[model samples]
Target: DRCRVTILHFNDVYNIEERPNTEPVGGAARFATAMGKYRDQNPLVFFSGDCLNPSMMSSITKGKQMVPILNSLKVKAAVYGNHDFDFGVDELEDVTMETKFPWLMSNVIDTLTDKPLADGLEKTVITWGTKKIGLIGLVEEEWLVTLATVDKDDLKYLDYVEEGRRLAKELKEEGVDLVIALTHMRWPNDVRLAEQVEEIDLILGGHDHDYDVKKVNGKYIVKSGTEFRNFTKVEVDFIGPKYEISTMKIEVTSAYREDVEMKKIVEEFTSLMSDKTATTLGRIESELDGRFATVRTQESALGNFLTDVMVAATQADLAILNSGTLRSDSVHSAGDFTIKDLLTILPLIDPLVVLEATGTQIIQALENGVSQYPKTEGRFPQVSGIMFGFDPEGPPGSRVDPNSVKVDGEYLVPEKVYRVCTKAYIARGKDGYDVFKDCKPLTDPDEGPILSTVIQNHFTAVDIVKGLKPCRSGHHQSLIHVASVAK
Candidate 1:
């Protein structure tokens, strides 16, 4: 018997509706349009994973809003992304139930029960005509540790390579013809799995958002870039007892029109989001500009404001935060900073923390923070209440001359102790600040509480900077800009 099957895949869609500014890209309607066209010619449509959470739009809706749109597109099956657990296991279970398609997570298990956390559907079997397509889903284990929202006690992520071997063996024993490994793990992990696992015919990937299709260790691996900009279509032609992929095409969704029906669904959701976003609390005195290419490289008025808030919130002598944490540097145009704007800037739910450290540890920590400056490291700290200078041209460790560095007009005393205010992310050694990993925690805050709420309560209002002067002193220069109330 001869059979033909096509697998349509897109990773990291992240709630991008097809229309222009009216909505984000990769909306259900737009994806439906693309899926409908393919389904008309074929019968299978598969999403690799990472279709939910991480966006303000998705979070506000608790992922319920995406179900109808995905159902409309006839998404047969999708693997789970790390963000799927952003709201917690219960919310994720709700999303799985609401979704018309089967949400597969072969690597995620209940730590207490040692059973699959998202189980109800078959883990590794999807049929197309007479051919049996084995589908195995893999989520990154590191997500259990990195994500601020997820509770380690509630969930357990099994090793991808080990899970891959176990599932592949089971699927092959069941007379599966081709094995498709849908993963939320990055390229290196996928490559390692491909090399180790012999039965995996294709590795469909997400997470890193790099667009590339390459064969590693005889396995075909494909990843579409983030935000539904593109998708990969793999056409399999079954010849006798064997199946071979005859045609593989990368379809750019941006080239085609958004599906009309899906567009309507998106428009309705967009209207709801807009109405909700209109409730503004306070106003900015001046425009808060955050053009990333310009401001992030130096310092942003918004960034300074956030650091000041962290300092005040912790009542620490100094504060340090990453510029990358400020997702967008869009200048405020004399308007209310809505809840949406705040979420966009600070997407992660990292809580503020105060740590006791000596002046020497402070300088070491600051050096660790600015160590990767100009390169735009996400953990790069934007300081408050304290100022220091650095020379990128000089040696890495010697970049900050002790003579030039100062805290309130005096050289840093290596022996003196200082109370530092920073996000829990830094204290956990997330941003390459391993020095703080062993440091005693002064405060351990809960997740889900908004930092913006703290800012609103502390400061009456914000006054944006206009034509802020650059801080330069002798051979060293301070990267921070903007002014904020001292703690």
Candidate 2:
């Protein structure tokens, strides 16, 4: 008996629609159109997770905005992701109830009750067909330590390889002909899982934010790039004991038409954001570049502006933030800046947090921040009210020059305390800035203003070169651009 099954997958989706004003490469509406074409096959639409929060709209709707769009797509099941907990367990539970599909998570458990936290989550499943396929969902266990919103006592995540292998073997024992793992984990982790658990026939993964595919032990592993830029389709043809599988990458392009039904749902959410996004937040005197190629590897004017806003808003001695937070991916030419533009640039909804750190701790953070200078790493520090030079060609942790650190025309005193403003992401020690996490908390999360609002206020309040002293110019004299040195 020959039968065909099409497996469609995407992950790390945040924006419910397309890039603010870019191509049709993203958006739930576009994805709906892409999926509609294969609806005849009754394809299994699998999501690897991370969609519950992080986009500008999620801040407003608390992840409710994604439900209708996802419901329209008819997703079969999705795994858990770190970002899914951004809104805390209760809010995530609300979304779980609203979803039309199964939210799978086999490793996440409520320690006190000794069961899954939400009734909405699926433990394991055998999808019925000519060939039965067992499905299991897994998330990286590290979120147990770093996830911010969840109470430490509420939940626990079991090790991925240990739990996943145990579950996959059971599915095999249950007489399922094939087993698949939908995982929200880095590709390397998935590769390791494939090696350790050979029974799992395929792995659909997320979290690296890039388009990737690999074959290990004659099994297909795939991850569609983040934000729905592409979706991977796996066609499996089975005839009795024989089976053939093939994969293709499908781009959601401007050329693709939106499904009318899903388009309405997308547009409804878009309309809610249109006014906020379109309104002019402030003006810029010169072009600010927030391009990833620029900010992640160099001291960017956009980074300077953002850190300057943090300093001004928090009234801290200085502010430091990672360049990776900027997501605009394009230069903002000098002119009016809209709320939408800022949202696209600083996509995360974290609040501005102020912390107290001594000069020694700060220097350690500066060294750690620039450890990945030549390569593009997100921890590249953008600063306000200070200056420093680094030897990028030097070893990773020793790159920053101690003699180079200065504030207000004086060298930083090791014992002196200073107030520093930073994003909650970094303040919580993400991206190699652990010294920041050890610092004394100054601004409480609830009291701190939302970062974008602070930047908007800074622009509205100052509005002139004289008031914007150190931040007036974007160029940093301390360290030369790595690209320039490379040339």
TM-score of each: 0.63, 0.63
Candidate 2: regions farther than 4 A off: 20-24, 118-122, 274-487
Candidate 1: list runs displaced more than 4 Å.
19-28, 118-122, 253-255, 278-319, 322-487
Clashing pairs in 1: 16-24, 16-25, 16-26, 16-27, 17-24, 17-25, 17-27, 29-262, 290-329
Q: Which candidate is the best by TM-score?
A: 1
Worst 10 residues of 1 by lDDT: 470-479
Cα lDDT tens digits for candidate 1, 1-487? 7877888777776665654653224555566666667766666667766555645576456556677766776778788776564444545676678877777778777655566764533265877777888888887665554332334555766788888888988899999988888887777888999999998888888876767887888768888766665677788788888777743555544545777777787788777886676556455556666566644466566666777665554456777776666776677666676657666666665556677777777777767766766775675667776777778776655666666656665777877777777777777887777778767765543221235444433322121122232211111111222345212
Worst 10 residues of 2 by lDDT: 472-481
Each model's lDDT comes to 0.65, 0.74
- Note the clash tally of each candidate: 9, 0
